[model samples]
Target chain A: MDYDYIDRLLERYWKCETSLKEESELRTFFSKSDMPKRFLPYKDLFVYQQIQKTVGLGSDFDVRVLSKIEPPVVKAKRLTMFVRIKPFLRAAAAVALIVLCGNITERSYFADDKLDYNYKDYKDTFHDPEVAYKKVSSALMMLSEEIKKSKSQHFPDSLYQNDLDSVCTK
Target chain B: MHEFSFQDDILPLKDKLFRLALRITMDRAEAEDVVEEAMVRVWEKRESYSNYDSVEAFCLVVTKNLALDMSQKKDAQNLSLDESMAESEMDESDPYHQLANNEKLKLIHRLINELPERQRLVMQLRDIEGESYKKIALVMNITEAQVKIDIFRARQKVKQRFLEIDGYGL
Candidate 1:
């Protein structure tokens, strides 16, 4: 298939005379699987021509050189969910914390220890002052005992909730 | 201004720049330095890079200039001939490993390097980089015909060398 022409092209190619298209044709001609023995000698050259397509500096070259360039600029995405919702998440957490602390503090506020219980004041406040005080004191003593027991025994927090419910039911 | 990714417009050219540097300086370390300097020059002066054709070719031209300057300076140092030749061999790494098992192409690649510097440059720019004739002519600052002649001569050399090694298939 135009072997003479290819041979001539090969001759031109060696002397730096052939055009790129001609050289490529020569390569393609030799690239076929059925390249004749007469053409086999030229086969590798064509194959190598194609292979030169892969040649260049090695792979790590970019890594080596670009190491000195500025570190990549990270542009913040205006629409990313995490970024858009970040403020809300923080605010929610802060509100939750404040609410939790306030709830705890409100419970502690009612537990103030400085009660000036004058006998007359106690009498005025109760239908049966002695009986009512005795009942209230006994209930408080029971609650205090349960709290101490739970603290020492490491009871589930549900026990505290239950205690609050039962005692506050009165 | 050239509008493109660092990868698209710049990073991808590393191997080509490396090859150009390696060809001129023939030492990996020195070629690497040249490529870095070239990249810096490109990046720093990129504002002047009008969004015209062939940004890659522009970078390559800059790299070639840098490598050529370095090589010329070293040549001026008047090193011993033996030392200069040895340095040239240092960075001339094999471009064949990238090829498939085609001996013809390997032979041609070697022959292409054996070509005169002008011819080799022509082939590298036109064939290896797939640059357009106009763009390559611009890069080399040569007229289109000179580029064509040089490339033609380079291909002819490769073909001749391949045939000679093949012994005309015995």
Candidate 2:
């Protein structure tokens, strides 16, 4: 029997020129028991690869891996419009409660007191314009005096200038 | 687009992923762990599966990365392929042929395992798994040229080593 085809294929295989199909053919040819004596040396290489193909994990491997892995995510239930908006609705309700409480507290603490005060009876203590003018002039004079006293206690400009001049000179 | 189901689409790829992980980690238990983690990761990103060109390629890439990480972390030792397992797979009736075939198989395994990591992985993906060069490139994050080069180098090395042993009766 002529092995010229297999020899040619094997040469191409070692050269990395064989197509996947041709390589499979070589594997098949080498797998048989009736190969010529000269081809026996190369037989083991192909046979070993064939055997390695069968080297795989046992059936239990699937169970082991599946147990470790999470199952495929179940398709999510279609949410109703209300269900989708529930979180936003809760937030809006919280905000509305806060605002309502704020309004109530403000009315309790401020509105009644403001309304009870009599704005209509708010008349000026000084009915005469001349007397009111004199009281205003006196208050202004006291304020002027206090301003003069504070000005007198201001940091001395001459002392500040001296410190500055000394530092510059140094 | 066909719907991607974890049970139908992804889980069936566990054996392929396991073989890839096993090739890298060189330890069955570690490879199993890597494959499990990879599956879980792919499941976690299931929503984005459609974004990828191929979910199978994506799973392979994930498994490769996890296996690399595990192997690196442990400084993967050169664990021999289980001989008993291979023996059980043999259906030979003659004891003489079985013994000789087993020795040859062992030699082939050692030759492959002795290859550099990238070459070993490329050969495994190309020869055993029958992956396309494009897919191997995607999984390994290398150019198709580089994948072919690695496969070529790996096959040549195995051939050279096997010839050296067989010729000298080592």
- Which candidate number has the best lDDT? 2
Candidate 2 positional error at B33, Å: 0.5
lDDT against the true structure, each candidate: 0.71, 0.82
* Tens digit of per-residue lDDT, candidate 1, span B28-105: 678788988888788777776674366777788888888888878887898653586555444334343334334444
Task: Supply the TM-score of chain A against the true chain A for every candidate structure.
Answer: 0.35, 0.40
State what share of the real interface contacts each candidate retains.
0.57, 0.88
lDDT, candidate 2, at A18: 97
Off by over 4 Å in 1: A1-29, A57-59, A71-170, B80-110, B165-170
Q: Which residue window of length 10 is worst by lDDT in model 2 chain B?
A: B91-100
> What TM-score does each of the candidates earn?
0.56, 0.63
Q: What digit string (tens of lDDT, one per residue) describes model 2 on residues B89-140?
A: 3635533224335777867776777688899999999999999999899889
Deviation (Å) of B166 in candidate 2: 2.4
Q: Quote the lDDT for A161 in model 1.
A: 82
- Assign candidate 2 its CAPRI class: acceptable
The CA lDDT at B63 in model 2 is: 94
